[model samples]
Target: MLAMSSNPDSPRVLICDDDAEIREGLVQVFERAGFTAYAAPDVAAMERTLAAKGADLIVMDLMMPGEDGLSATKRLSGKGAPPIIMLSALGDDADRIVGLEIGADDYLAKPCNPRELVARARAVLRRGKDADQPAKSDSVRFAGFRLDVARRELHDPDGVVMPLSAGEFRLLRAFVERPQRVLSREQLLDYAFDNDSEVFDRAVDVQVSRLRKKLERPGIEVIRTVRGEGYLFAVKPTS
Candidate 1:
């Protein structure tokens, strides 16, 4: 089932939850916050709504009947996918890290304050908008590789395109932008994710590790870990 509110000028948000009351309540909350909100009973209905009427953001629940939110989120990971804020009863640090690693932009535990959710949505949307703005340079080159900021693509020295997840891309971009400098996990979180995001330092480590694997080559270290400090991008980037 899908319920929609009409507001052509407002940002569109799709709320996908199994609980009817929670779904409708979210729709109303987003509506009051100036979003053109839509409610979907599950991931399938959410997909239907997305195909029929594109959304700016998606509020997804972790547990559902057919497809769980984590699986759906992993399927939705890619360029142009709408930002997702995951809601789950499993509120442990491990669960949140898994959600983020899979692709959710933000994770909120169940029974969260409606106002806080709205605030987080606005912050995520703002980050998206900021990312859409024109960069001073179209791309940056580092360690014989090129990062196309606008296209969100990375090409190796051989011109082969390497696949990067949303989190990996952001973390890489932050490193390249501030190459040759040791950046603390806290700083990386601010640069790579929403400043208010509840992501832990461990999540940053995980993303950095994944990024290092992609940028890996024999005998060349691009990112380095500084004991008792943080990580540093070993090479300087050229615009």
Candidate 2:
């Protein structure tokens, strides 16, 4: 049976999954973890619920009947919506990278431990709330790619917007801010995650690889790995 929590102070979480059993199971987990959880069977229901009552976080499944998670995630991201954690039955680096590129805050493979999901939810919520604060203007432009720190957005040379997850944006920001500097993994994590993110070192590598792919273009190589050192933003970015 699906369980709902009635705590006003609890964060509101909306889970969108096609499987009834999985939906109910996640709802029970979230409720047990002190969140006011709601479940939707698909994207349509998820949208309706969000339109009626806003959500603090969204747990979305990757595969759905009509609109897949990537499409829904892109739509939500374009609107600057709430944080989202994508769950997928396919546990692969490519899937996780794609989810993040579409603006998911986190990605977890299905059959995930409920406790770990709770921890990720808490961490993502913490970062989301922190990001909601106003900040100073900071932007870096190089090779036609612009990193807008204030907006946490990336714009291509053609002025097209490229969606980036929180971690991806932050990592790129760290690089552009310190162009031509070789930063170790520890330094990168400190700058990007602020030591508060749940991501680890190998995950940092994955994010870098993904960001590099986005920033790469003809005759322009933005990032380079130093064998024993770390990574360097090879170009001199302009503010």
Candidate 3:
């Protein structure tokens, strides 16, 4: 425990980076912004910190001396894992894809503006909140596949809950919230990612494929690809 603050109102965020300067700088930024920031040098220390003090989010550097951030992300992707913002010099398109593919909630290039970093962190938290949310919905049920908004779970006829990534959950939730409506990838990205930045349609397609595997049940065509239009969730809801 790094001396808990008496003010219990602030959310705690864990910062893991190999660079001392980067660690201290981020700590200062977070604390100045009304957050409790814990710094660690590696994933081992991060694990220790998480064990002692739970975090609302994690800001991690990708290239550490020992186990890299990617390894850490994969390990931490279990159920109810906290949101993560990966920082790295590898800001190439491929690197971002890999980071997102392996459960990272967001990515930021190093030497980034601190304000942008803070904004991205908040955005990630929002996305996390959105994923775990159970908003009022029509309770869509199609061909034995069930989406329960109140439960925030996808269920098969066997009554087994399906695992969904934060991204996958948001995408499906957007569709289930408004069934039989054709949504282009851009619109889906706007709601699911909550980003104004234009996202390629292939990204949505990939997420749909992943979601389909999770919703693998009989007689359900939850996501239908429409030629020259977009994808639609063709199902009526049930109680």
Best model per TM-score: 1
> For model 3, what is the error of residue 2's alpha carbon versus the real structure, in angstroms, after optimal superposition?
6.1
* Count of backbone collisions in candidate 3: 0
Off by over 4 Å in 2: 1-9, 74-79, 92-98, 132-146, 156-161, 186-190, 193-206, 213-220, 236-239
- Pick by TM-score: 2 or 3, better one: 3
Clashing residue pairs in candidate 2 are none
Better by TM-score, candidate 3 or 1 = 1
lDDT for predicted candidate 3 compared with the true structure: 0.76
Report, for all candidates in order, the number of backbone clashes: 0, 0, 0
Better of 1 and 3 by lDDT: 1
- The superposed Cα distance between candidate 3 and the true structure at residue 46, in angstroms, equals 1.2
Regions of candidate 3 where Cα sits further than 4 Å from its true position: 1-6, 137-140, 148-151, 196-202
Q: Residue 76's C-alpha lDDT in candidate 3?
A: 79
RMSD of each: 1.6, 3.7, 2.7
TM-scores for every predicted model: 0.93, 0.75, 0.86
How big is the positional error of residue 60 in model 2, measured in Å on the Cα after superposition?
A: 1.4
Off by over 4 Å in 1: none
Tally clashing residue pairs in candidate 2. 0
Among these predictions, the greatest lDDT belongs to 1
